[model samples]
Target: MTLRNQVLIWIAFFIVLMLALWIFRGILLPFVVGATLAYLLNPLVNQLQKWRFSRGWATAVVLLSVVAIILGLFFMLVPLAGQQVGGLIQRLPGYASDLQELARRWAPELNAWLGPEQAARLEATISDLLGRIVGFAGGITGEILASGWGVITTIGIVVFTPVVAFYILLDWEGMVRGVNNLLPVQYKDEIRGILAEIDSSMAGVIRGQGSVILILAVFYATALSLAGLNFGLAIGLIGGLFSFVPYVGFAIGFLLSMGVAIVQFWPNWWMVAVIFAIYMVGQFLEGNILYPKLVGSSININPVWLMFALLAFSLLFGFVGLLLAVPLAAIGGVLVRYGVRKYKASALYLGENGDKGGDQTAV
Candidate 1:
């Protein structure tokens, strides 16, 4: 194919793929989740294969072991998190009352500092804010569920994800070979090189970052729980999970931990200080130790570019887009660099003499 024709064909293919994803987005969640699982678990299957297991048997064993681990974690953690959530909801009113009393106790100082009129305005504002917080806290779960409950049901995901993962894992090698066979003959080697780069980038960012998130979650959850903060487990897990979004996770975990500590142990002050110290230590460990060791060198995408890609994809394709954003961003980054390299080497970039002459003679 001519260069222009090849470009057109690839563009058309990309457009068609995007159109299909948009059209079938609602039902795509399970498949996307399954594919992601398969990708993550592929290494384990490869390890088993090295031990002389057939592909089918390896896949089955890995999936079963994963299922068992998930079930155990689900049963053990879900109930405790749920209890914490319920207790937090129940205590909102009491927390509000206590906060109000605390504010009132400082009323004299506030009046002396700000004058009666400003202090009165501040008190009224605080009351209104507290009321809004309580109301929002009470309904946030229901609001989230009502908005997202139908996107992918619990039953559908649980039933379909494993089946999709299994078949994909079993046929993984053949599928790779099939795709490789379809590459254009002229650019096959170059395309393969790009694919290799994409694979490396994906493995670095996704797998390495995954390890970072898991470690952070465990650390936060364990530390908070050991510190005896109310709803520590939930706070730690949520913070850890949210760490996928960068600094957002640390902010969320710290704020939630501190908020709970203040409410549960206000007069004592020591416990609140302990919670603050835990978060500080966690942040230090993540920033200085974990991220650098696992993810620093591997990340080629700029943070600003990453955030933009995530926001753009999420807006375009909702949840499925969010799931795909990282991999797609990595692919796009590699392709862009390849394009720039090609461009820089072309005659157009060097006044038509670059390709024919050595670098010393180029414009």
Candidate 2:
């Protein structure tokens, strides 16, 4: 085939593959997740096998250990989260009252600025806004609890994930070899090089980001708990997990925690200041220590590009898109780098030094 024909064929193949991935994405998530788990656990399984353990035994042990860790975290976090949520729910009414009173005290100053009639209208508008906010919050909570089929579906996914992961881990090497064998022989070396680069990039990003997030969670949770803030653990967990998306975690945790501290300990600026200080310290530590250590040499996606990728993917494919955005971005970066390298070597960009003639004629 001509070079142009080969290029066209390859483009068509990729287009079809992307379309298939988009159409069957829902069914693919579990498999994608399982494959990632297998990849991450492969090293540990190899080490176990090196210790003279049978492959089957090593796979079982590694899978079970992973499952046990997940189960333990669930058991530990659920009750704490439940208690915190329950307490927050119970205090909702009092928080509303306090907020209303605070607003009312500020209304007279509004009256002096806008006159009594306009001020009363402004106050009513504010009250209505507050009511709608509370109603929206209540609606979300109710939907989560009352949507029976949704709850069941979620539970099923949770239960089956580990089972899928276990089998994938057990057969990971065979799977890799099978895939490699299927690649076209002429392109096998290039494909292998790209795959290795992708693997290294993904491992660095996923494992490093995960470790950093865990450390930040512990730091934030401990600091908030020591400061005696209600819902501290929840805030910290949310912050740390979302920290993978740049400043999102810190912004969310800081704002939410500050708002809660203000309402719960009103007129006590000291508590509010302390809460802010704790979040600042957490941010400092993450920037100076955790991120540097964990995410070293990983894809350096700028904040603007990162946010754009998140927004675009989330809009296109919802949660799965959001989860895959960073990896996709990393892959795009790799492709771009390769393209740049090729361009630099190409005749169009090389001027008089172009590979147009034989080596001896290239002055």
Candidate 3:
């Protein structure tokens, strides 16, 4: 095919793929989840195959192990998380009142520093902002928990996803070969290189960072709860979950922990110090150990771009979009970089002179 024809064909293919995704979005969740699980677990299956096990046995073993782990965690942690969530919601009003009381105590110092009018305004602003924040937090939390439970209770996901994932895992190599066979001969190598890059990015983000998030979540929740910090479990889980975005998780957890610590343990000073110490340790492990060991330099995506992709995808496709956002973002990032490289090498970018110096300058 002519280059233009090839380009048009690919464009049409993408459009149709997107249309299909949109048209069948409601039923795509289980499939997407299954596919993601398969992707993450494929390496384990591969390892087992390397050990001379059949693919089917390897897949079954891996899937069964994962299911056991998930069920164990669900049974152990879900009840506590649920109770904590309920308690947090129920205490929102009391927390608000406490915050306002804390603010009232600061009124004297504020008045002395900035005079009555400004302090009054500042205090009112703080109170209003606090109320708004608390209200929003409560509402969003309830909705999120409800939606999450609804998804968990979904019969299709519970029943069908395993079958989908099992077959996909069993035939993973064959599927890969099939796709490889379809690639145009002329562009096969280049396309394969791009796919490899995408694979690396996806693996780093999903498997590596996923490990990081899970470890951090467990560490934070356990440590904070042990430290007796109010709402520690919730704060830790949130912080750990946000850790995928770099410093965001730390910042959020720190702020929430500190706020709660101050509110709950103001005069103790030492306990507050202890909370700070726990986060410092967690940060140290994440920065020095977990990220270095697991993630390394494989993920080249910018945090800003990742966040934008998440927001955009979530808005466009809801929960399914959220599940797809990171993988798609990785693919998008690889393609964009490839396009840029191609653009820089083209005569159009090189100009009539075909200056190599321009390429260096572009770099």
Highest TM-score model number: 3
**Would you list the C-alpha lDDT of every candidate in the order shown?**
0.83, 0.75, 0.85
Provide the TM-score for each candidate, comma-separated. 0.84, 0.79, 0.90
State how far residue 77 of model 1 sits from its true place (Å).
1.1
lDDT: worst 10-residue window of model 2:
140-149
Residue 246 lDDT in model 1? 61
Tens-place lDDT digits, model 2, residues 311-337: 887566555566677877777667667
lDDT of 1 by residue, 84-107 (tens): 877876876787787778878989
Instruction: Return the clash pairs for model 1, or none.
Output: none
Worst 10 residues of 1 by lDDT: 143-152
lDDT sort, best first: 3, 1, 2
Backbone clashes in model 2, listed as residue pairs: none
Total clashes for model 1: 0
Rank order (by TM-score, best first): 3, 1, 2
Clashes of 2: 0
Show the colliding residue pairs in model 3: none
